[model samples]
Target: MRALTVKQPWADAIAHGEKRIENRTRPIPPKHLGTTILIHAGATEDFNALPADMVRAWPKDVRAVVALATLAGCHKAAKPRCCAPWGFPDTWHWELKDIRPIPHPPRPVRGQLGLWTVDDDTLAAVQRQISIERTSA
Candidate 1:
């Protein structure tokens, strides 16, 4: 499965279903739109970008796949502060849907810059978690 490496609190926010819009400097590729991808929390943290309360509450699960979400659509900000605190002006906002948090994260994997393909072992691990999540739900 494809995956995207996002920095700290932001990745945690997505996993918790608190943030649905991912701000990026580039538009989403047409091929990737509407596709479900893993949300990998990178090793870095954007502490100042989020409020202190949120930061303290969110898990800093770096280098791990925390959730799976569909890239529903992508659009420019169109206005200043478009998607509230999550969206920023002059950036493409990637809308996410069907966000399923992986309650049991797999082993840590190295992250990449953009959308990337997960190795067979990692993909298998994530798939197992998804199966468990579905069964329990």
Candidate 2:
């Protein structure tokens, strides 16, 4: 599976909050649509974007995989403020669905810029957690 490293509150929003749209400069590649990807929280936090109270509620798990989500679809922001507060003008809104948070993050690992591939060991660890999640559900 592939992974995408996102900034603090945004990543948390996808995992535990009600953020279904991820605003990016580019759209998700056609091939990756509908693929399940890991949501990794980068080391840096974007305090300027989200409110302080919202950020405080999110788990501070930097450089860690927070959730598994499906890259459901992508669409350009046709209007100035199309997708509510999360959407930005002139950016592609990558739709995320079926978000499943990893209760216990696997071993901490560095993140990359875009939709990067995860190593076999890291994939295995994430798989284990997903298995547990399924059985519990």
Candidate 3:
């Protein structure tokens, strides 16, 4: 599966269904639309950089794929609107849906820019985790 590395708080927010739109400086490729992708939490964190309210809800895990979400669509934002709460002017907003957390990620992996492929072993592990989550639920 393809994955995107997003910074903390935002990644956590998306995983927990708190954020529905991901703001990007550039648009995602058209082919990615309607695709299910892994949501990788980046390794870096700057608690001081985030707003106080956001810092309170931050997830502890970093440098791992925390969730899976469908890339519902990508749109160009003419201005800051309801879709993206932290959106910047003229940025691309990627709509995400069906966000589900992995609970315990299979393993940690370094993140990269754009959409990157997940290794088979890791993907299988993630699938196992998903299976466990479903059965338990």
Give per-residue lDDT, candidate 1, residue 33.
82
Poorest 10 consecutive residues of model 1 by lDDT?
Answer: 128-137
Number of clashes in model 3? Answer: 0
Candidate 2, position 11, lDDT: 86
lDDT of 1 by residue, 1-137 (tens): 78889988899889974899999999888888878888999888887877787778666788998998888999999864688878888999999988998877775788998889888898788887775232110
Q: Judge candidate 3 at residue 2 and give its lDDT.
A: 87
Off by over 4 Å in 1: 132-137
Residues 35-127, model 3: lDDT tens digits:
888999888866565567776765647888889888888788864365646555677888888888987875588899899898888788889
lDDT of 2: 0.83
Every model's Cα RMSD, please? 3.9, 3.7, 4.3
Q: For residues 76-114, could you state the per-residue lDDT of candidate 2 as single tens digits?
A: 997647888777789999998889999877658789988
In TM-score terms, candidate 2 sits at 0.89
* Model 1, position 114: C-alpha lDDT score: 80
